[model samples]
Target: MFTSQEKKGIFSLSLIFFFQMFGLFLILPVFSLLATEEVEGATPALVGLAMGSYGLTAALLQIPYGAWSDRIGRRPVITFGLLLFAFGSILAAMSSNIYWLILGRLLQGAGSMSSPIFALIADLTRPEVRARANAMMGGAVGLSFGSAMSLAPFLAHYIGLSGLFWVITVMSLCGLLLFWLAVPVPDQDPVKATQPIGVLLKKVLKQPNLTTLNFGAFACSMGLTATFFMLPMTLKANGWERSDWWEIYLSLLVAGGLVMVPSTIFAEVKNKFRQVMVGGILMILLSFALMAWAWSSRDFVWLMVALYLFFVAFNVFEPIFPSLVTRLSDAESKGTASGVYNFSRFAGQFAGGLTAGILYHNDLPFLPLVLGAAALWFLVRALGFPNPVRHASPVEKPE
Candidate 1:
């Protein structure tokens, strides 16, 4: 069980994550429409670039951001990152062209606070209960994602994409304020690595466990961006209006959230992390297969099934991966390790949007097949991955 302090820390940090991701995800369902209809000089290729530009910058900067946090402290880095994010949101809100929007996105990604925030979580929580802390964080992110999906289309209809960006700006500021006001500063000093920076990074890169988990992060995020890129279009083809897409997403979110709560507990309590992780990968593979069939047949029922399955699979992965990363990493390089993980994850997001959009415009039929192939490869890699070493049961903090 969490101490009261631990609970406060987790809740505050989770809210920060919620604000950041919620702002970013609010554009997922409606960005394509905004690109096609509103932005001048928008092409299919440009839409893909604009969609992915944030990830590109995020992927490049996460390592440095993480490393900086190790040197300068997490709070300072996180606060600056939130400010950058808000500035970008404001810029994007003002954009009238695709180029400007992409630039805003690129700037937004420059914040790159995920690594430090996660590293801070590791610092604040005990190992045995770390997974539970992360689970709560994942739950916050999941709720934000669900809320974003359920609201995006409806909000876009009423507010326009520009107005949506304004909302994101507000959210970013809220996250900034919450971080300073609520998040507990870790009492522990930063890990002082004896090795050189290059050597430390190289060591992190060489760890088989780290690399495997990194790949998992990449694959999961890639699949997500690609799936969102395709999902709205597929639903449109099946006669669902843009505004009505929220209903499907909301229903699936509720269903997936229910399943996720228990499965995460079972994985942690029963010490079945590897089994749960493997099951999730297989489930993702199966979801792609089902979605492939649905796309071809235009079967609404099958599509819903596939989507729900993906939601469940993703939620399973969300909490488990970071906890595993924390366990697998050494104390000195926790921030760097998380940086690499976030790098891969964001890179995958960029690639997925860019490639999926290209394929969709050039040869729509081949998109799912490509995504399925990636999932298959991910499963093969996951099969050989090792489980995290179990720690002793965590003790609560003193009252």
Candidate 2:
């Protein structure tokens, strides 16, 4: 449990991130189905493109957002991003066709706020304690996933997809209020503030272990995004309603959250990042395999089992990888480093969705698992990469 200040910081960060993620995921339960309806020309690939365009645009802006945060300070850049996201949400709500929804998600990603939020976190936390802060943010995210999955299915059923978009707009507006009113800025030490970006970049680059870590980030996102793209279709095809699908998603989410704490505690004691990554990769592969098996058997139980394991790995990795980034980065440029980490992730989100979309056009439920095999290969590459030298910087507050 956190003290009062830490608690507030964690909640504020979670709320901001929740609003952002809710904007992204509200359509997950039904968007693909909606896209294939008669009015939309029923092109699955285009729906994938529409769903993924936001990720593509967000990846492009991460580095710039991090730099902007460093140059101007975190609050202003974050606020600007949130406003842009709000604009995107409203535009999406009013869109007439799948093409217009694509435009809206793209604009939303263009104003992605993750980099700025992380930069503020880095500024606020001390070095030694940074990992805990990250854990807090990650925990918040897990909670948001559960809440969003549970709420979105019913909400989508009642209000329709466009209504969900409007709801996201309201959430974003509320985030703007919390960001402005609830968060506090840490006083920066000028010496830390003036470090040149290139200098910081070089310092991080010298770390030999970055390849594996970043690859893991990329692969993990790919697996999850692709899985998500398939999930609604999977459940529906298996004869489950949207409400039943939400129950499945929420159950797995809670199970994942329950496992994450113990896994991290064990990881810390053993210093087993390589082992952790390997375990997560293998588990993800198993989820895909199970999915394949379920399809063969046509059983909902196996499908649920696969999802439960998949999310456990996902929850472990989300916090574990970010903590590792904090551990490995140079003291001065944690902001830029985390931005790049998030960059790899959203980039993977784009590629993952497009890959599944194309494959989906060819074959339905089998696609996500086939891609999962490729993700396993990427993880193999990550495992073979070299390790970073320990800088032994004082552990700071979690970002």
Candidate 3:
């Protein structure tokens, strides 16, 4: 069990994470619609670019922001990130064209605070309980995604796309406030980097296990981006109105959350990280297969089932992946290592969005088959993943 301080840190960090992700996901459901219908000078390809532009900027900056947090404290870097996010939200709220919206998204990604935030969570907890702490953060992210999916369309109906962006701005500000008022500072001093950035990058990249995990991140995020890119269109074709997507998302995500709770407990409590990963990847493959069948048959019920299965499987990895990264990485270089992992993740998002957009534009409906192949690759890699120590070692102190 966590002490009061650890509990406070975990709780506060989770809420802050929730706020940030809620803002980001809030736009996902309605983004394509906003681009094609409301914004001026929109093209199918540009819409995809606008949707994914943030991932490019975020991927580019994640390493520097993470390394910077290593020298300075997490607080200052996180605060700056939130402010940049808010400024971008404001710009997006004011934009009447796709180009400005894409620029706003780019600026928002430039903030790139995820690595530092996770590093802070690590600083606050011991290795024994770190997975649990990360699980909390993952739970927060899942909840945020569900809430945004359920709310965005309804909110969009009432407030328009600009208003949705404004809501994001407010949520981000709330996160900044929560950080200052609620989050407990860690006791350890910041870890200063002794090696240069290039050396650190090489070290992190050379770890075979981290390499596999990085590949997994790329594949998983690519699958997610492509899935969402196609999901909205699928629902529309099956008779669900744009605003009513919340009903499906809310129900399916809730079911996923239910399965996720038990699966998470089994993985961490039973020390079955490798099994969880393999099983999760398998689940991803099965989900894609179901989606392919649904598409071929135009079966609405089958589509819902596939999506529900997807949510269950995807949520399982949310906490486990980061927990593994932190555990496998050197204590002194936590921020840097996290940055590398997240860079792969966001880079996958960019590629997935662009590829999906191009395919959609060209009338080539190949996302499910492509994602299924990616999942197979991920599964092959997971088969060899080293089973990390589950509470077998003491938390290493920074050198």
**Tens-place lDDT digits, model 1, residues 210-311:** 788898888888888887777777677678998898887777678777867787788878877778878988898899888778777767788778877887
Q: Per-residue lDDT of 1-399 in model 2, one digit per residue for the tens?
A: 445665576667877887767656667667777656622544778877877788898888886677666666777888898899899989989987777888898988888878778767665665444556777787777777777888887887788878888988998898899898988656553124366777665665665565466667777777677778777887777778777777777787778878787777666555565666777778888888887777666687887788778878888777667767766665556666766777877888788778778885453466656657676776777576433233345532221
TM-score, candidate number 1 = 0.94
Worst 10 residues of 2 by lDDT: 390-399
> How high is the CA lDDT of each candidate model?
0.83, 0.72, 0.82
Worst 10 residues of 3 by lDDT: 390-399
Model 3 ranges with Cα > 4 A deviation: 361-364, 395-399
Model 1 misplaced regions, further than 4 Å: 362-364, 392-399
TM per prediction: 0.94, 0.88, 0.95
Error of 3 at 308 (Å): 2.4
TM-score for model 3? Answer: 0.95
Per-residue lDDT tens digits of candidate 3, residues 314-358? 878878778778788886678888888888888888877777777
